[model samples]
Target: MKIAPNSRVLITGGASGLGLALVLQFVERGARVLATDVHEEIPDSLRGLEGVSYLTLNVTQDVDWAKARDWVTETWDGLDYLFNNAGVAAGGRIELSEMDQWQWIVDINLLGVARGCRTFTPLMKEQGSGHIINTASAAGLIHPPRMTEYVAVKAGVVAISESLFHELKPYGVKVSVICPTFFKTNLTESLRGKDEQANKSAAKLIDKAKLSADTIAARVIRGIEKDRHIILTDRDGKVAYAAKRFARPLYYSMMKKASFQMAKKD
Candidate 1:
């Protein structure tokens, strides 16, 4: 699953954040990149990039995915990499979360990946070589409070990627799940929650995150090159993941403490 020069790559949510970083990197590496987002207009930074095309794609819609697949087939004849990076952030306790919010988050964050996989996997299988990189979150690996909807959907993304990794390995297609901590991204701007104070606290946490989206993108590229299944970007994310794996009770305790502190801040 080496991303060589002229490799055809498709990235969702490519207008900003991690997706934009990936688009820049892939284009710099001589890969032909199609960067898709829900926005009707391409971002100013990516508008004139060489080896890159901007397209409108709403990941939650089946028709949008079909159009993307057709575009790839007609333009590149095949796709070598599919990055399921489009997602939105939502927060709130599970008990306080509304069904509409859950549906919206699930549609974009979880089922979006599923739709991309279903649409592009066959093309990858036919070509005999491809890779799918899904963007989960550190929250997916470690349960943090006040982000129940986001965590649940991201956990689903991780689970889907794991299943795909095993199922697609024998077929020359690699699958990797990226579980990264907060970074300088517009994800916070899209945050949906009823608790204004909790949202403010979450935004503060994001502002304090050390890694940038570019750093996360670098790790993602490395993960792809090495075919690493679980890609963790930040040190905190890696450490938290390990804690959750080997010290579940400790991890839970820490999360509960953090949750209580956030509530106090609110």
Candidate 2:
């Protein structure tokens, strides 16, 4: 599970945010990397990096996975790590979200990770060594109010990653799940234009919350080196998880109180 200097790695959704941070870190660590996003135009800064390459990938499609696999096999001869980090964001309570919104987010966030594992894990298994990293969320561990669909999908990611970890162990593949409270990323944009009023209100609340992308990336790299099963990016995340585990009734009571306050205001 150690990512050696010359390891070949592929990352989905590497065009920006956390994926971009991972690509930068790995490239600096001496890994040869191929990154992809559904969006065209890889960032100019990353274009000239010697050991890194970029491509357009729509992770929801089987054909896209095939092309990514072909590209890595042709370029690197084999793959050492497949980071299933591509994701989309959605904002709204379950009842408020449109059906298409639910479908779109789940397809891209949850099922996309599943598809990546399905198509690429075998390639690594055949080679006798590889790693799979799935990006879940702190929301995955606890279903907070107002993020029903997102929380559910992320929870599924954690479950899928844990299952893959055990299943892939027989094949010498490793699986890790990342759960961060909130890091500065384009995921927030998923709510953009969906519901401007509610989004602005949420934005104000988020602006008061403090977390950094650079810090999260650093932690993730370290976690990967250690082959951690569940990588937590924030101190608050660890604390929150522990609190929820040992004090379930208190946690629910506090959450219910907060919900009542919000409702009373509404």
Candidate 3:
């Protein structure tokens, strides 16, 4: 959990956004890293790195995960950390969002993380020391309107991560889930929805975010060092979670008010 020198780390979705930020941060911290993505070509950010390597891994594909597992088991012989950070975005009311879109987001966002855990958990259990970091979202916690598909999958991620945290603890492995609010990232590049206004509003909030991926990644690194679980990686996220917990009636009122106002604008 210290991210010690030469720590063996593998990160998914490393081509861009928060995943890219995590890859760079790990490399800078003297960790020997494998940065994997669905893209065939390596990102320029990870090119020609000494301690960092790149591989093609589609988190939803069994073959890609098998390849990634083999790479870690053969080349590094062990893994210190596995980052299940690969995910896409989707937003719309339940009736508005297509079933195919729901399936796509579920496959990549929730089940993808589950697959990563299933693939590497035995390795980590055998090694007796490893950490799993999963990426959830504040939407997972807030359950805001107009994001049914996205919220459901992310909430599932949060659930699974908490389950894994307890399940892996007895095996000497650790699990942490990060629920970050909108930050400066390309996460919306994969956004899918039937509601154009919802999509645009989501993208606009992301554009207006003051927190950068680098800042969030840096905070996550610190949280990992301390073995902290359930990291809400921004001031807004932290405050919102606090408000939700301590002031439920007020929180629900605000959420309802915001939803109606947004709908009126649309």
Which stretches of candidate 3 lie above 4 Å from their native place? none
Cα lDDT tens digits for candidate 2, 1-266? 45689888898988778888888888888988898888778777578887888888898999888999889888788888888999877765445678888888889999999999998887889999888999999989977776777888999999999998999899889899999987667666666335554566566655565776667877998999988999998888887788799988877986788677656754
TM-score of each: 0.96, 0.93, 0.97
| Higher-lDDT candidate of 1 and 3 | 3
The residue-level lDDT of candidate 2 at 254 comes to 67
Task: Estimate the TM-score for candidate 2.
Answer: 0.93
- Ranked by TM-score, the better of candidates 1 and 2 is 1
**lDDT: the better of candidates 1 and 2:** 1
| Full-model lDDT for every candidate | 0.89, 0.83, 0.90
Model 2's number of clashes is 0
lDDT tens digits by residue: candidate 3, 1-266? 46799999999998789998998898888989899998899878789877889999998899999999999999999999999999999997677898899899999999999999999999999989899999999888888888888889999999999999999899999999989999999978898888888889899999999999999999999999888989888888887888899999988988899889977886
Of the candidates numbered 2 and 3, which has the greater TM-score value?
3
* Candidate that scores best on TM-score: 3
Q: Give one digit per residue, the lDDT tens place, for model 1 in 194-238.
A: 877767867887888788899889889988888799998878888
Q: 52 in model 2: Cα distance from truth in Å?
A: 0.9
Quote the lDDT for 242 in model 1. Answer: 94
